[model samples]
Target: MNQVGSLIFLVALFLFSTFLNWYVFQAYKTVLSGVDSERSKQMLNLIYWIVFGGISIWVVYTFHQIFKAGEISTAHQQVLNVFLTIVVTQLVCTIFLFGEDIFRNIQAGFSLLVNGKSETSFPTRLKWLSIIAIAISMVPFTSFVYGITKGKYNFTVHREIIYFDDLPDAFDGFTITQLSDIHAGSFKNLDAVKKGVDLAIAQQSDLFVFTGDLVNHEAGEIEPMIDIFNKIKAPYGQFSIIGNHDYGDYVSWESPEAKAENFKKFIKQHERLGYKLLIDEHVVIEKDGQQITLVGVQNWGKGFQSKGDLTKAMEGVASENFKILLSHDPSHWDYEAKNEPRKIHLTLSGHTHGMQFGIETPLIKWSPVQYRYPNWAGLTAYQGRFLYVNRGFGFHAFSGRVGIWPEITVIELRKK
Candidate 1:
C-alpha cells in the first residue's frame, strides 16, 4: 500500500486496539473491587500493567518497525512475541465477560417478575467470575509462550510407505526424504536450525527433494544459513522447484532489472546448495536398467501463479513409466495434476504450513487453512494417485509455530 493508505490503516488499528484494551481492563477492575486486602489490590494493579501496558507498547513497536523497515522482517520477533501473548489473553477474558453479562441479565429479569421492580441487588461484578476468567486465560498464555520458545524448533519426522502397482522392480525399496518452505529469512537460531538439517541428514535416503520456497523474498535472506543447508546429502542427488515467494513478487523493487537480478541470485543460491533446480522440466532416474520419470513444474495454483506446464514437463516420457511429480502448492494436485491426461503416481508438495497452528492428534486433525484448501496437510489420495503435503521445514510471518510443528517427511516406495 501507499504511504497515505498505510497511515490510515495504522490509525484505525490503533484506535480499535485502544478500545479493546479499555474494555478488558474494565472487566478486570470489577473483580478487584470485591477484594479488601491491600496486598491483593497491589498485585492486581501489577497484573493490569503487565497485560494491558505490554499490549500498548507492542502496538507502538509494530508501527515503528513497519515504518522503518517498510515491512515486517525477521528483526521484529520481539514485537510479535508480545502480540501473540496479548491476543490469546484478551480473547479468553472477553469470553468470560460475555458469560457474566448473561447471568446478570437473567437475575434482573427474575427480580422484576417476582417483586414488580426493575432493579436487583446483584453485584455488578462477581469475584468468582473474574477468577474464572484469569484462570482460563492462563492456559493459552502458557501454550503460546511455549510455542514461541520451543515449538518452532521442535522438528517432527513423518514417515510413510506408499505402495504402487506399476512400480519398477529395480527401485522397489527406494526411499525419498522431502523438506519444503525453508523460508530461510525466518530462521533465528542457527544451532537449532542445524539440528533439523541434521535430522534430515540422518535419514540417509536415496534421494532428497526440497519442494519450494527456499527464501521469503530475496536470495540474500539465505546467505547465513546456506552452509547449514548444504549439509543435506543423498546418494542419487537433490532436486528442487520454485515457489511463489522465491520469485520475489511480493516486495517492491527500484526497477524491473533489480527484480530480475534478485531472481538470478535465487537460482545461484540453489545451485550452491547442490540442488538441481527444475523449471517446468523432467529428469530420468535410472537404476539397474529400469527408469522412473521425475517431473517438476513451477509454482502453480488455482488463484495464484499458474506457470506450471504439465504437458511440457511430460513431453518425451512414456505414459507407462511410473512418475513422481514435485509441486510446491497442493492446490495443483486438485486442479491440474490429478485430472491430467498422463498419470502421475505420486506428487510431493509443501506450501500451506498447516497455517502454523491447529489441533493434530492421532484421533483428529484440523487447521483453519483447511477451509481455504481442501488438500491441506498429510497424505491424501485421489483415484490411486497420492499427494503428500509436507507441514514445512521452517516458519513465516508469525515467527513461531504452535501445535503443528515443523516437519521432515520420509516416503518409502514399495512395489506391489
Candidate 2:
C-alpha cells in the first residue's frame, strides 16, 4: 500500500513537471505563431521568462537531490528542506500559471462561438484551447496543494468498535504513545529525530509503540542517531514492527540473502535502541496481575506483496488475552484487518504518514491518501476493534507537514 503511495507520489511530481512543461511549450508556440506586432513580442518575452527560467530552477533542484542523496548530515538536511519547499512552491505555481492561460482560452472559445470571430489569430486561439484541460485538473491539484500547505487534514475514528474488554480497571486512564513512518533521510537529521523521540518520552506513556518505517530505504541512515532513540523511556516497554521500508526493497540488493541479512540487521538496530522488536510474535505485558498481548507483524498490505504473516504470528497465542497489534499499513485492517477472526482489540499502524501533506482541523481535512483509507490518522473503531493510524513521528522524502504536523498519538485505553 505504501509502495502504491510512493509510486503515485513520485509519479505525480514527474507527470506534473512533464505535462506542465508541455502545456507551457504549447502556449509559447501559439504566442509565436501570430504576426510580430508589439503585443506578440511582449507576450513572447513573458512566455520565455516563465519557460526557460522555470526549467532552469527545476534542473538545479533535481541535480541537487541526485548529488546529495548519499550524504546525510545537518547541512544536507537543511538543503533538502529548502529543496522540497521550492519544489512544492513550484508545483503550486505551475498550476496557476497554466490555469491562467486556460481560463483565457475558454473565454476566447466562447467569444469565437458567440461573436463569430472564426479567423482569430492562431496564437490567440491556440493558447486558450491548449490550457483548457490543464486548467480544470489544476483546480483540484491546486486545492490539494493549498489545503495541504495551508493545513486541512480532516479525519475521524471508525465506528465499528466501542471499547477494549481487557483494559485494566486501574489503567482506565492509561495512555500509550505511538510513533510511525519516521523515514529519517537526507531531509531529517539526528536533532530532528531526537526532538520526536524526546517528545514521545515526555508523554510519560505507559507504553510506546513504533509501527515501522523507522528509516526510509537505508537502514544505516539512522545509525548515527541510534543513541538518540535509545534515550526513549517507557514503563511497559517500547515495541516496534517492521514497515515496508525496513525490508531493503527500496534499493537494489545483490541477492535474496543480502536483503534477508539487512532486515535482520534492522531488527538488531532496534534492539540496540532498547526497543523490543516484534517480528511476527507476541509478548505479554503484565502489570500487577492483569496482562495484555502485544503482537507485532511484518509489513502487510492488501495491495502490497510482503513478508507479514499474521496467522503465524498468532499461532501459539490464546484467545483469552487482550491483543494490541503492531502492523504497519492500515489496509491490513481491511483484510478483516483489525476485525480478523483473531479478534484483535487494538491495532496501531503508521504507513500512511498522513500523506506527509494535508491539514487536520475541526472541518474539511484531506490528504492524497484520504482516497484510500477511511481512518488515515488517529484512533478509530473497527468491527469491535480499535485502530490508530498515527500521523507518524517523522517525515520522509518531503520534510515539512503542510497541514498535518507530525503526531505523537497518546491513545488512552480505558476498561469497559
Clashing pairs in 2: 105-128, 152-359, 153-359, 153-360, 154-365, 333-337
* Tens digits of lDDT, candidate 2, 328-349: 9988876756657768888889
TM-score of candidate 2 to 2 decimals: 0.73
Native-referenced Cα lDDT, model 2 = 0.69
lDDT of 1 by residue, 273-335 (tens): 999998899999989999888899999987888888888888898988899999999999998
TM-scores for every candidate against the unseen true structure? 0.89, 0.73
Which sections of candidate 2 miss by over 4 Å? 1-162
Runs in model 1 lying further than 4 Å from the true structure: 2-12, 37-57, 60-70, 110-117, 120-123
RMSD (CA, Å), candidate 1 to true, equals 2.8
Model number with the top lDDT: 1
Q: Candidate 2, 387: how far from true, in Å?
A: 1.1
Evaluate residue 79 in candidate 1 and report its C-alpha lDDT on the 0 to 100 scale: 76
Alpha-carbon error at 382 in model 1, in Å? 1.5
